[model samples]
Target: MKALRHVLRATTVREAIDRVPEAFYERFAFAFLLAWLAAPLLLWWVGPVIGTDITFLAWVNLQVGLGALILVALRLAAHLVPPRDVSWRVVLRDELPLVLLGMFLLLAVLATALSPTAEALDGDWYRRESIWTFAAYVGFFFLASRVVSGVLRRALLAGVIALALITCIVTLVAAISAGWHTDEGAVAHRAIAYFHQFNHYGYLLAVACVLAAAAALTVARRVLRGGLIAVFGILLLTLLLNDTLGAYLAVVAGLAGLVTWLAVLRRLHVTTLLLLAAVAVVVHVLADALGVGVAAEIASLGGDMVAVSEGSADAASAGTGRWGLWMITLEQIAVSPWSGHGIEGIASLLPGGYGRPHDEYLQYAVFFGIPALIAYVSAVVVVLVRVVRRGRAVDGITVCATAAAFAYLISALFGNTMYYTAPLLFLLLGIAWAGVRAAGSELLDAESTPLAEDRTAPTPII
Candidate 1:
C-alpha cells in the first residue's frame, strides 16, 4: 500500500489522468460534467424565476461570463507550462462567419437603441438573445477544446451518462411520489423526469441515446458494451416515458441519419440494414393497429400523439398563440426587408410585450434582416459541404460527428435549438472541426516526411 501510494504520488498529472480510463480529451465530456454539476441549482432556480418573469436568460448569461473567466485562467496556466502549438487562428478560421454575424447583430442592436423608432424596435428578443448565445457557445467551444485532457474527455462522457441515469431515476421517483397525470387523464408517471417540460426532457434523452449508441458501436470490450447497453436502456426508457414528439422524431431522425450515412458510404453491413428496416416496419404496423393514443401510452408513459406534436393546443393557445405571434413577427420583418429593425427592434414590434419568436430563422430575419440570415445559412452550408467531403476519408468518429451535425441542422428547422439546445450543436461542430484538424495534420506529416507512407499506416475508413 505504501509502495502504491509512493507510485501514485510520483505519477505526473497527465499520467495520473491517463490511468483514469476513457478518452479525456473531448470537449463534450467536460461540458457534460459541468452541466451535470450545475443542473440542480439550475432546476431549482430557473422555473421559479421564469414564472415570475425574472428572465432565466440571466442565469445562462452568468454561466457564459464565468466560463470566459475560467478560459482566460486556463490559457494563462497553460502558458506557464510547456507551450503547445495550439492555434487560436485555426479556431477563428472555422468560426469567422459566426463572429461576423454577431458583430452585425451588435451593430444592429446599437443602431436600434439610438434610433427614434427605438420603442418600436423591441420585437427582436430572439435575435439579440440568439446572437449572444451563439457567441457564448463559440467561446465555450474554444475553452473546452483547449482545456480538455484525454482522461477528462472520457470522464465527461461517462459523467454525462451517469448524470442522465440519475436524472431518469429522480424523475421516476418524483412521478411515483406525485402520481401525476396529463390533462387528458393519462398517467404521466415517468414523463416529467427531472425536467419541467416534456420537450426539454426528450431532447436531453435523445442526446444520451445517441452517445450511448456511439459507445455501443465503438467500444470493443464486451464488458464495456454491457455497461453501455444498460445505460442506453435507462436513457431509452426515460425518453419513452417523456412522450415528447419532437424528441421522439429527433431520435428517429438521428438514428436514420446515422444508418443512412453509413449505408451510403458502404460502411454498414447489408444484413444490419435489412434487420433495422424490418424492425421499423413491424413497429409501424404495431403502432397503427394499437391506435395512436394507445400506442403512445404503450411506447411512452405519456399518451396522445396530438399532445406530443409541436405547437400543441396548450402551447399555442397559452402563449398569445404562436401562430398569431409569428404573423406579427413576419409583419415586423416585412417593415425592413433589407436591414429589418435592429436587434432591439423585435420587442418594439410586438403589439403586446411578448419576449421570443420561438423560431430561430424568423427571429434572425426580423432582427438583422436578410443579410444576417444569409450569413448564418452560408456558414451552415460551408460546414455541411466540408463535412461531407472530408468525412468520406476519415474514421467512424468523424462520420458520426458529421451525421450528428445533419440531425441537428434538421431539428433546428422546427425548434430554436441553435444555442438553446444546450451544447449539442457546438459540441458536434467542435468534433467535426477536430476531425478536420486531425486529417490536415496527417496530410502535413505525410508531405514533410519522405518515408511517411512507410512509417504511418493509412487511416482506416469507417
Candidate 2:
C-alpha cells in the first residue's frame, strides 16, 4: 500500500510539471534569443581550444537544437492552451523556401546513394547535420517573430546592437595597441579580436560599422548618439586597418544603401549627413595621429588589392576550374533533375572532391535539382516582393533591414553566405517582418481609438 501511494505521488508531480502555464513556457523564446546572441561569441572564444569539436558550425547546431527544443515545447503548450488564433500563414509564407530547400537536398542525397563517386566525396557528419541546423534556425526565427511581444522584440534588437558595439570596441583597441607603421615598414602585430580568420574579423567590423551608423541616426538621446559615434569611429578604424576588400566594399555598399533609403523616405536630415561626415573626419584624424605605421599599413592594403586583382585574373585565365565541377554537377543533376543530387549528395559527388561548390546557386542546383531551385527562388522572390511592396514607405527598421538584405544578396553572388549564414539572413528577414507587423498594429490602434472614443462619449436619447 505504501509503494502504491508513492507511485501516485510521483504521477501527481509529473502532472503538475506538464501543466505549467503558457506564460512560463514563453521564457523559452527569451532563452532561444539569448542562445542565438551568444553563439558567435562563444565560437570565437572556445573554438581554438576545442578545435573542430566546437567550431562555428557546431555552435550553430547547438543553438539550433536548443531553439528547436524550445519551439517544440511551446507548440505542445500552445496545443493545451491554444492561442486566440493559431495561424500558419507566417510559417508558410516565411519558411517555404527552407522547406523546399530541404526537400531538394533529400532528393539529391537519395539519387547519389547508388553512385560509386559518393564514397570519394567530402561527406562528413557535421556537414550532414548542418542541414537540420539551418532549418531549425530559420523556423525558430519565423516563429519567434510571430509570438514575441514588441518589448521583447526591441530587447532583441538592443542585444544585437550591443553585441556589435562590443565587437567594434575590441577591434579598435586591438588595432591601437598594435601600433602603426610607415610605407616601407610593417605594422605591429595585432590580436584577431575574437575571430579566427582575418576575413571574418573584417566582416564583423563591417557589420558593426553599419549598425553603429544606424544607431547614430535613429537613437534619440544625445549621450547615446555620441557613444554610438565613438563606436562607429572605432569600427571604421578597425575596417581600414584590416584592409579586407570584401569587408570594405560590403560596408560601403551597405552604408550607401542605408543613406539612400533614408533619403528616399525623407528621413535623412541635414544633421545626419553632417554627423556622418564628422565621424569620417574624426576617424581619419585618429588614424593619422596614431602614426604607428599608418602609411605602411596603407601600402600593405594597396599591395593586397593588387594581389587580389592578380589572383582574379589568374582564375579567369584558368577558366575558374569551377567549370569542370559545374559540368560534373550538371550531369548528376540530369540523372535526377527533379530532385538533383540529394540534400547532402552534391558535396559527395564533386569530381575532384571539393567540399563546397563555393557557389551557393550551384550548390542549390546541384543538390536539390531544377525543381527545388525554382521553388527556392520563388520563395525568396515572394518574400522580397512582399517586403518591398509593404515597405514602399520607409521607417528606421525598414531602412536598416533593406540595406542588410541588399548587402547579403550582393555578397551571396560570390560566397555561399546563405548556406552557412542563414541566421544572419533570417535576422534581417525577421526585422522586415516585424516592421510590417508594427505598421499594421499601429494602424489598427489608430482605427480603434476613434471608435472607442465615440462609444464612450455621452449621448442623449431624445
Candidate 3:
C-alpha cells in the first residue's frame, strides 16, 4: 500500500526527463547496437528448425523496437533541453550524413506508397526491407553517431572482433566435422556459419576481417595488436574456406583503401607496409597448403572476365548468371528511373528464378527510385569524407570503421544487403561519424589554447 501510494505521486514527464541524465539514453543506445550484433548468432542455434525468414523478421522487429526507444529518448531530450545547448548545436553541425540517410528513408516511404504491386508498408515475403526497417536503420544510425564515444567506442570495436573470432571458430569446427565435403562428391566450399546463406556470412567476414586488420596495424598496445592479428588470420582462413569471390575481392579492396588512407596521413611506416604484404603472402600460402580451392575460384573468375572481354555469347551464360541479370536490371531502371517499381520489384522481371539484382546500388534504384539511391550513396560518401577530414586526429577504431565501410561497399557491388549484416554496416558508419566529430572537437580545443599552455597537442591517436 505504501509503494502504491508513492507510485501514485511519481514525478511528471518533464520532471522525469530533467532527472535523467543524457548518458542514460546513450548507454541504452550502445546496448541496442550490441544486441543487434548478437541476435543473429543466438538465432543461429535454432535457424535450421525455424527457418531463415523467421530470423530475418526477428532482426527487423528488434531494430524497430530498440531504434524507436532511442528516437523517443531524443525527442524527450529535445523538448526539455534548450536548442542552443552546446551538445544540441554540435549534433546539428555534424549530422549531415544522417540527415541524408533520413531523406532516403522518407523517399523509400513515398516509393512504397506509390508501388503498384508491393503492399503499402510491407514488401515481399522473402526479404522485407520495407520503409519501417529503413526508418529503424536511420534511427539506429542517429543514436550511434550521438553516443559512440570513449568506453562505448572501445566496447563496440571489441564486440565486432569477438564476434568474428567466434564465427570463424565455429565455422572451422563445422567444416572439419563434415569432412569438408558433401555426400554429392563435391567440395563443401561455402562456410555459412551463423548466416542463412554463404554470401551473407561472407559479407560479415569481409567487414570484420578488414576492420580487425586495420585496427591491428594502428593500435599501440602490444597485446591488443597481437589479438587483433590473430583474429584477422582466423577470419581470413574462414573466408578462404568459402568460395565467395566477391568477399575475397572486398578484403583486398578494403586493405588497399586502408593502406592508401594511412599513407596519405603519413601514419603508415615503410616497415608496416612490408609487414602487411608479408601477412598477405603467408595467408595465401596457408590457404593453398590447406587445399582451400581459392585458386580454382580465382581461375574461374578470370576465365569469366576473359570470356566477357572477347564478346563471347557464352558470357551471357557465364558463372553466377549476373551479366544477363544486370542487363535486365538496367532495362527495368530505364523504364522507371524516377519512381521505382517498389521493394522486390525486380522479382517479376528476372529470369531463371533470380529474385534480386545481386547488386546493392542497382537494387536500391529498382526498389526505391534513383533519387533514393543517390541519397544513400551520397550518405556513404559523406561518411568517408568526414573521417578523411579528421586526418591524423582520428583514432584506431575510426580507421577500422573506414576500412569496414570500404569492404561492405565493395562487396555490395556483387551482393545485396542482408538484414543481419546491414545494421552492422550502419553501426560502423555511425562510429566513423562519431570519431570525426570527436577529432574535430580535439582540433578545435588545440587551436583555441596557447601553444605553451597546450600540454595535450593533437597527436595522431592510435
Error of 3 at 135 (Å): 2.1
The segments of candidate 2 whose C-alpha lies over 4 angstroms from its true place after superposition are 1-26, 42-60, 69-73, 76-129, 178-190, 281-359, 370-381, 392-402, 418-421, 437-462
* Structural similarity to truth (TM-score) of each candidate: 0.62, 0.67, 0.86
Model 1 scores a C-alpha lDDT of: 0.51
TM-score winner, 2 or 3: 3
Candidate 3, residues 51-141, lDDT tens digits: the string is 6533564455556556755567655564545354346545545667877887898888888778755643664554556666667777667
lDDT of 2: 0.53
Model 3 whole-model lDDT (C-alpha atoms): 0.72
- The reply for model 1, stretches above 4 Å from the true place, is 1-61, 69-134, 145-159, 184-196, 269-327, 338-355, 392-406, 417-420, 438-462
Q: What is the lDDT, from 0 to 100, of the residue 51 in candidate 1?
A: 62
Worst 10 residues of 3 by lDDT: 453-462
> Sorted on lDDT, highest at the top, how do the candidates line up?
3, 2, 1
